[model samples]
Target chain A: MLRKMRRRITIRIDMTPMVDVIILLLIFFFMTSTFREAEAIDVQLPHAYAGVRIPKTGVYHILISEDGKIYADNEPMQSREEFIQAIVSSRATNPNLIFDVKADQDVEYGVMLTVMEDLRRAGIVRFNLSIFKEAGAW
Target chain B: MAGANVGGGEGRSRTGRRRISIHIDMTPMVDVIILLLIFFFMTSQFKEPHGIEITLPKTDVPVKIPESNTVTLRVDENNEVYFNEEPVEEISKIREYLIARQTENPNLVTILDVHPSAKYKTMVDVLDEFKIAADETGVTKFSLAMKREETAPEGGGG
Candidate 1:
């Protein structure tokens, strides 16, 4: 008597091309995406017509809250003296440091001036005040 | 016997084929990637937060600001703006004054002296007015000055 024969079927899927495309897309997004810098405090900047772009490097961000609270690099300072000390220490390492003062629009001008005075005392002459661009006309 | 023979023949025919091609649907993946691309494209900002164009005072080294053809503006504690020690009733007056001044001098330099007790917004508004007026007439020299701190009064214990 003759024995019955059996057959086997095989299936294959190539994931190489699909994976290559996915990786390319991921890389594109990763390279192009830019994350907003985290701030220690929030400030509503005043609007001005003479707004100009500032360089990103060597900038020391100082945030002034609406209630006149001072923040340096996401850390709250107890007083202007403390803020100045921090700036002096940072400036010792980086002489080309540029202070970027971010003050709330509603904040009293006296508080902002005090901060400026402190920065001056710290030997930081080169500083920029952050302002929003005016909407309609220059 | 015939049914058994037919079943054996069918089984032998089934073993002839191998290597079946598998297809994975990538439409869903493509859709998701496109959505993400749109999201990022919309959210990305090219312009950095801008800074006011006026220069600040230096602590150690003081630069000589030209007094010739200069206009001095002051903002008081009550947000009142003064042009050359005279109170300005409207912002347009400032623009008009600068334009008229620019026509005569052409090299007009505007100096802003802001009081410490004034609101920050008031200072910005004055600056904005200055900027508009200066730009309209092609005047570039501008400086921001801080009010001198008050000296302590000589007195006995209260």
Candidate 2:
């Protein structure tokens, strides 16, 4: 009875270390994560099983939100003239420069096509899309 | 018995009294740092700033582009400009933004994804901004984000 009483009645697994590590990891991902806003547009993106990460060191980016918003690298531009001029300058140095487009899924298809047509008129022939891979975990 | 001492000793070891050293190879850390730095450097993404009041056309295209460092321009059905994804109200602002990106990386390029119903004129106007800025600030070279059209029915079939 005495021995039984002396035996440890409770056991504990120290999760402090694990919790500390998890905190550190979370902080790391948050700090270093280039959290490009997936919600830049209000539209629910049409989900697909395919997406590749394109490194954007040298590409032009365009965004169209669900509300029909237009942005060039996050700057709100007012006229077609300004938009075209920007593209032309980008192309002047690297004829192979590409455009990365992000638009709300609800944006009119006709509008997107029209923009491409305008590019051809300005003598630009190359561009690509910038998309996010499925959210697996940060 | 040994594990308890080992665990308890962890506190004492921190005081550096016993001279026990924990060796963590920094090679992997360096590799990860370099890789992440390269990724952020290469992706060169900008913030979204402006928006217009137009709706987007729905599509069933199943292909999605991968995430990368890219310049994005958004267009609405009414033909407006949004930088990065935000709505920009001034040409000068757009000019400065382009110049800044070019300044950061000489090889920096751009991408344009517009709503299909967006106005053709709006697209032209957006391109014009880049061209003018590049000319004034010396930003050269750009790319389009969309595929070429098989026909030119734009501008009311011109």
Q: Pick the candidate with the highest TM-score.
A: 1
- Compose the digit string of candidate 2's lDDT tens values, residues B41-70: 555344322222111212223223333434
The digit string of per-residue lDDT tens for model 1 on B1-158 reads 35534545676745754547777776677677767766666666555778764344443444454567678788888889999999999855787888788788987667777787888888778877777776687776666665455321111000
Q: TM-scores for chain B, in order?
A: 0.57, 0.46
* DockQ, cand. 1: 0.35
| Candidate 2, A1-138: lDDT as tens digits | 888789776665655565555556545655655555443345334322223444535656676665556666666556667767767777787776656666555556665665555555566544443333334421
Question: How many clashing pairs in candidate 2?
Answer: 103
As a whole number from 0 to 100, the lDDT of residue B8 in candidate 1 is: 58
Off by over 4 Å in 2: A1-16, A23-32, A37-44, A49-51, A93-96, A130-138, B1-158
Point out the worst 10-residue segment of candidate 2 chain B by lDDT: B149-158
Each prediction's TM-score against the native?
A: 0.68, 0.38
Steric clash pairs (candidate 1):
none
